[model samples]
Target chain A: MVLAAESQLRLDANWIDYLLVAFYFAFVLGIGIMARRSVSSSIDFFLSGRSLPAWVTGLAFISANLGAVEITGMSANGADYGYPTFHYFWVGAVPAMLFLGIVMMPFYYGSKVRSVPEFMNRRFGPTAHLVNAISFAVAQLLIAGINLYLLASIVEILLGWPLWVSLIVAAAVVLTYTALGGLSAAIYNEVLQFFIIVAALLPLTLVGLHKVGGWDGFTDKVAQGPGGEEQLSSWPGTALAGFDSELLSVIGIVFGLGFVLSFGYWTTNFVEVQRAMASSSMSAAQRSPIIGAFPKMFVPFIVIVPGMIAAISVQEIVEFKETGQGSVEYNQSILYLMRDLLPNGMLGLAIAGLLASFMAGMAANISAFNTVFSYDLWQTYVVKEREDDYYTGVGRVATVAATVIAIGTATFAASYSNVMDYLQTLFGFFNAPLFATFILGMFWKRMTPTAGWTGLVAGTAAAVTVWVLSEDVTGTIAIGGQGGAFVAAGAAFVVDVLVSVLVTVVTAPKPESELRGLVWSLTPRKDFHDPDEQELAWYQKPTILAGIALVMVVGLNVLFA
Target chain B: MAERKHEAGAFDIRVFIGSLLGIYGVILLLTGLFGTSDADLAKSDGLNVNLWTGIALLVSAALFVVWSRLRPVVVPDDPDEG
Candidate 1:
């Protein structure tokens, strides 16, 4: 109830927090205003005039992926699971990026579509396109709103501000800049936020490490804990004390979670696609994923290592009889660590970085939502024309609208028992289905439009049905008994895939000719050369080297971890 | 020239397959050589060895960069096909 207690006792008088929040909003708004000139056309507004260099694209990609949930949730996950949580970054995400770069990007870029749904239409058919667009939109709403709520909680906690006040402040900052600048504004601000977060976190980790007398002393304290190795480094209760990873769990975490999750994230997540869309040409688009893959390799160090330090500190604190509400909600452990550890001006910067993370997340989502709404929904339905001004204007309007909706939702979510639980639950409801539809639509050329729609609708319905049927969570269909929502969603995906393939075979096949360009972009063509056909630029090699450096940095962490 | 065209396609498959083979080979080698000792060597209290898998990954990733750079550029006949 510390959260509730803390929620009631506000520090609105904290001028430093207010100033930091104000500065963030001012920066965002200034960018929005500055971007107005560049955004005359829809291409400029939505795609940053399709001229973002790979580094900007790469930085924006990482910023969008980090989000508010991840900044807080991964720390929470680390607190709960210790160092193994790093698997989410390394085993799952990075490899997936590599795979995408080597395999998937070529296909997507070769098609040269503006939106992912357009690619679906080009490759599969209208039904596949429409289904994915609808599912993705719904999934984004759930995720964006929930993340906004979680982030608002942190702002509320850090500044001693009220929930509505914090949510409003956060939403206004994101919306102001996003409404003016579109994708360019979002990416530009995100690049700045990425650096600010690193600036805040790196010193925090080093200081915290020093506070605990370096790694040796830290390990000694952890070893003396109640759970021994289990409490300190291993996932909270797992018996894999000395084992690198449990055989089955490693397979699940690495392949199932890593491969499937990473594939789903890179291939389907629209925020990531926003960067790809800004590429000057198809190769840039393809190479963009490769470039972006570089940062993901280092995320574990920036995120998980600090989290590992937190677990040690908290374990030490608890051993000394300081078992309080701070340690109870594992997600807040990082914040609690920061509050107790950080000194003055640095505290201001860290708080600013936290807020910046939230703003970056909200900006990306708002931008992505507006892009999809303007392109896939509004342009598809209310406005048929694809003119620059109309679409760009519509995108801006939708950005403001989504910001409002997310803010309203945040106020409601602030009262929820656990924002992460609620968001993950909602994510299970929709994301699994979107993941299913995208995978099938991309791989199964024999898939029919009818089958695609059926799979998506049925997949979502089944997941919801299972959630409802759980007499504990709700009451409805008794089918499948009580199961985790993700499990149910997974089941639904299997059924949907089976039903889709069966129906597709029974139904008429779309011509393979339609899919050739999108599906087989890697195939060589005679009498064809690319415009940007210089050897993958020299500066571009930094991304490669950065990728190498990131791996080395994390590799060093592993040697020391 | 026609025979070279066929040979190029064959070479493309080799590059793709060879890269894949190399990845598995490296993964297998790392697992075989360090898999057991990494467990004992990383047996520290707060440090987990699987975390070192990230290092092996970092090393393998170097290979990935080299592999990607070395990937046979198809060099389409038209300059704009990319």
Candidate 2:
């Protein structure tokens, strides 16, 4: 059985392939070296001195979200769940990204806040800042660690490389660039990675299409295969019919993943928002995510289609079934496609793209971790009155420390059965409540500092309780996997809102003068309109572009359905 | 502020990386198209993923270059100043 599986999935490469991979590494390292001189201060280190244009920041913003695990897992999910997997990108991502660009960027970019936790401090108080900053810092570390572990696993699987070597090399590369040049290095490399990933996947999609004939032929082949037709449907009847009874219903997707998780992640997660916040101007900041949305909407084609193709083509599933392994290794779907479908030179380039994405993801998390640690924690607590250079040094040190911690965490993560599932559960535990705090703090003038902290704590508690009870004991609660997370997050959001409203009604609110630029009602809106934007044609406007993206998303949903 | 001004005029790294990839990608693509044997093609399940990917990489690189040229990075005066 093992031999059959091994032969079914090829894992051989030659010297020329290694040469191509070496070139890719050299180019990435060169970018980092070139960017080092630009990091003279803390601002440049953390926010790229807020000087990048929309396109640079935009691609980075989207790319920062695209980790190796995300790319591989999405493809795996495509194989497992079919077209419905796109719910993650479309319903789960696009709207929230648009919301961040239109509604949230003004507050984040306009207030000149250094970090999201600082924004929490300004809006709520010191206690709220401490809670948020600590949570965010820890979350980024875990995420970075998991990304490291995932990359190492991919290398081990594909190249027969030892796990430790992959982890060390990835850690070293990420640490060198992020610690040296900071966020600029991270963002620039993300843009380059974005191109590489797209380039790598485009061919896979085309080859898969040509092999299966065309879109119609592809769909027909999948439908003719075992459980293929059902998988091809983007909307599997009603929400209840589509998901497992224990997982999300239609209502759960709309409210839980869409409203709570999506909004929580896209709008508030500092790792993603930092990219948009690095834009040169308010207009650029707003336009950044909008530009990102265009590419984001089409990403399913690159990541998901290949997985769908694998579902029909790969025979590993049958062998696994015959062997009674009791599990289909769906996560290896993309690897199977690569080994069977890509030529020698192309295989090397694809592997390089995979490596680039892993680095880009790790660099993004490390940059965010260092910034939060230095700005929100170290500067706030350890040394309050520090020079600019002192903080910059601290940030660099934090990068190294974070990478070490991540390496350790990656080792720990190796014990988990499924890293992707573990991550979703973690996000539910943290971000759901974090979003609750942000929603109330931003929109509600009557919400007090105590209320903000209380809501966050209570929301996290609710999510954890639900998750624990569901996974360990009764299994009655819908909280084991991603769907369970959505339900738990939704429940947490409700609990948070109830607690916040209850606390706020009794507690005293911050003074209106102090609340300026922090709360929605009290904050005066600044006109973000640029004359340059006006100079462009109407269709080129950010609003118009966002509108078009929304229409396309809807069109895709309908077409797939 | 002076440092900021000097940085604006510094080499656009996006274009540099794009051009580098574009050039190399074109080379790999040409090689994939013209140099491969039937056995080599058979190894890839009869699909020329290399040529297709090379073309895609070149296009992406061109897009990056064009985007950088169209809207060069503009340094905000005293961006760090309150």
Candidate 3:
């Protein structure tokens, strides 16, 4: 009764907290105003005119992906499953991020394509490009809706406002910044948000760890908690995988999560890739994701560790962990900690940090969507031969349109939250197939355009089929848990490679001459290297940084495991 | 060969980060020093969290602002003006 009485839906934020949040909003809008002076062309509007330095693009690169889902969802995963939740970072993200920086970025940056889908247009012609563009646009809208929905929910909880008011205000803030300054506004705000997020999370983790008697005491308590000692270790990750067989779980992790899903999403998702593309130079672009990998690897200490501590310290999380019978959602792990631990000033900073993250995420999606819509969809198909200024205007218009549609989708999400699970599985079918098609088309110059589109279609179909046939997150025909999505991704990749090979054999190949910069083997050495690369210090080079990141990640795995 | 493209007079991201962090840092530092009560310290497991975190934020904010001041970005000559 005492615990239940204390467990209210609202956080204890005072006027100072409100003041802090208002200051953050003013700065966010101010950044948009500052960014507006730079938007002279479509490229400026859509890609920051490719003028941002590596550190800016790099931090923005990771921040774009660290939405509400990351802070809340990862913490939720930690509360529910324990250390195995970290596998999402180590196995599911880091390596692929490194591979993207060291290997794939050169081709993308070298081609001088305005967007990722634009690269597809030049290589496999319009059909493949159209497929990628539409799917990417739809996916961004849906995901942005989820982010906006969560952002509104947080605002409602924080301010005690109605959901409708919160929704409009959140959407309006994102719309104003994105439509005003375009990607420049989004990227700059994202960099600021990234630091704010760290400031918000670090205090919670440090204070939580201290409360739980530091790392050693926390580990000991977790070993004795509701989930038992199995929660302490990371490998095999049977609890995280939702698989009974140890072999199946390990295989599901290494190949399914590590190889397929990781590569598919990190390498292909345009929202994250757009940040790297906005870098001032190819060297900056190549260095962007690599720079991001440094922070990406360590963020779990702040996010997931707090969740683990919450499982022991917070009554709601502890009760939910003990008996799955409470009204507590796992995502509330951070909020509960804030309510219980953070004083008024820190509380405001934490609230502002959450707002910044949600806005950063939605802004990334909106900006990426507008670029693809204005360039790949509108200019190529809807209208033609217009001035570059006209397209810049179109991008702004698209930004408004995308935010409005996302608000609609957010309402739908509010009503049918379960629909989000279904849609995520449905869209999870996208990245793996696209990755399969890209890796195949890039390395194998003999791949025809027909093969390109066909492979994409078949791979996505294969993932969908596997999801349908399986017990749908319970692992009857296929693996389940978070690992279930991994199996679906693996299935999509295998089927795509097989279909592309067969289709390429029968269809006429694109002539090698046309494959020049598009295909890896056909691309010149200059295409892969920045002309000024040698002049930079060793640490600034992508390859060296990627190597360092790889070793550090491996060392972290050993230390934690 | 493609010429190395450079633009001048654009917004510098470092200055933006530096200023924002500076503002948040100073306010949090002030709150920690003056407004923090014993109840606040008790909730935070007996540590002066606001004070410590405020100090940390101020330090980092100083670093960011100094870095930007030392290396502020400037746009090259506008070809249109040329």
Q: Which is the leading candidate under TM-score?
A: 3
Of 1 and 2, which scores higher on DockQ? 2
- Weakest lDDT window of 10 consecutive positions for candidate 3 chain A: A415-424
Residues A31-56 of candidate 1 have per-residue lDDT tens digits of 66656653453223333323334666
lDDT accuracy of residue A97 in candidate 3: 93
Better of 1 and 2 by TM-score: 2
Q: Write the per-residue lDDT of candidate 3 for residues A353-443, one digit (tens) a residue.
A: 9888888888888877888899889999999999999999998888888888998988876653222243436446888889888888889
DockQ category of candidate 1: incorrect
- Itemize residue pairs with steric clashes in candidate 3: B8-B75, B8-B76, B9-B75
Give TM-score, chain B, model 1.
Answer: 0.34
Clashing pairs in 2: A239-A250
TM-score of chain B of each: 0.34, 0.74, 0.73
Question: What are the candidates' C-alpha RMSDs?
Answer: 12.6, 3.9, 3.7
* Ranked candidates (DockQ, high to low): 3, 2, 1
Per residue, candidate 2 scores C-alpha lDDT tens digits across A187-283 of 6677878877877777777877777778988889777765556667766423312346423366777788788888888888988887777676677
